[model samples]
Target: MPRFMGFVKMEEGIGAPPQALFDAMDKYIGEQSAQGHFLDGGGLFGTEDAVNFVVRKGETTRVDGPYAEAKEVVGGWALLQYDTLEEAIKGQEEFAELHATYWPECSMVATLRQVADEPPAPAEG
Candidate 1:
């Protein structure tokens, strides 16, 4: 089986999702979880209090957020597994449809990426 990570991105401070969307998601997630596909997932808070430890050259710099420049941010994520990429895509599309049907007023992007199973090769000198 292959694992995929889904990131839901949207504008910061968007209003809460409707109850209908929540209800639909709860039912959908329950079904997927029971089948052992929805491994883990959760929503995240706004970036106002987010912290960043950025490295440039040999120095590390700490940055805190309330990022004025960022128009969109990752709002939630899901860890899932499927037998094939096609199945994963289908599952993700269904999930995205829930939002489209229930929360049409809000714009969002749901990105699905396959998780890397093995570590990458070492960096060249």
Candidate 2:
């Protein structure tokens, strides 16, 4: 199965009370898990508190936020496992529908990824 990362972008100033939002998210996770598609998922605080870094020349450029334009900013994400891209897309669509019910203004994006290969065997100590 391949792993996919999905981001749920929240509308500006649309955040709900933390507990309420978390409860809704938990319900969604439980539903997804019951369907065998949920691997892991969670919510995040506002982007200003998250970290973003970039490489420029030989130096690292550190930024304070996983910031983005208001319309495209991500508020939370989930990681899921699926047997095929079609399954992943289906899962993403389900998520979007659920999110729309609870968060009508939000949008979603999903990226498919394969796990990286294991590192070469370490030298004997």
Best by TM-score: 1
Off by over 4 Å in 1: none
lDDT of 1 at 92: 96
lDDT of 2: 0.68
Question: lDDT winner among the candidates?
Answer: 1
- What's model 2's TM-score? 0.68
For residue 117, model 2's alpha carbon misses the true position, in angstroms, by 6.0
Candidate 2 per-residue lDDT over residues 1-125, each given as its tens digit: 67778876655456563455456767878988887778877767777777777788888987886356556566667878788888888777776666556655545554445444476798999
TM per model? 0.96, 0.68
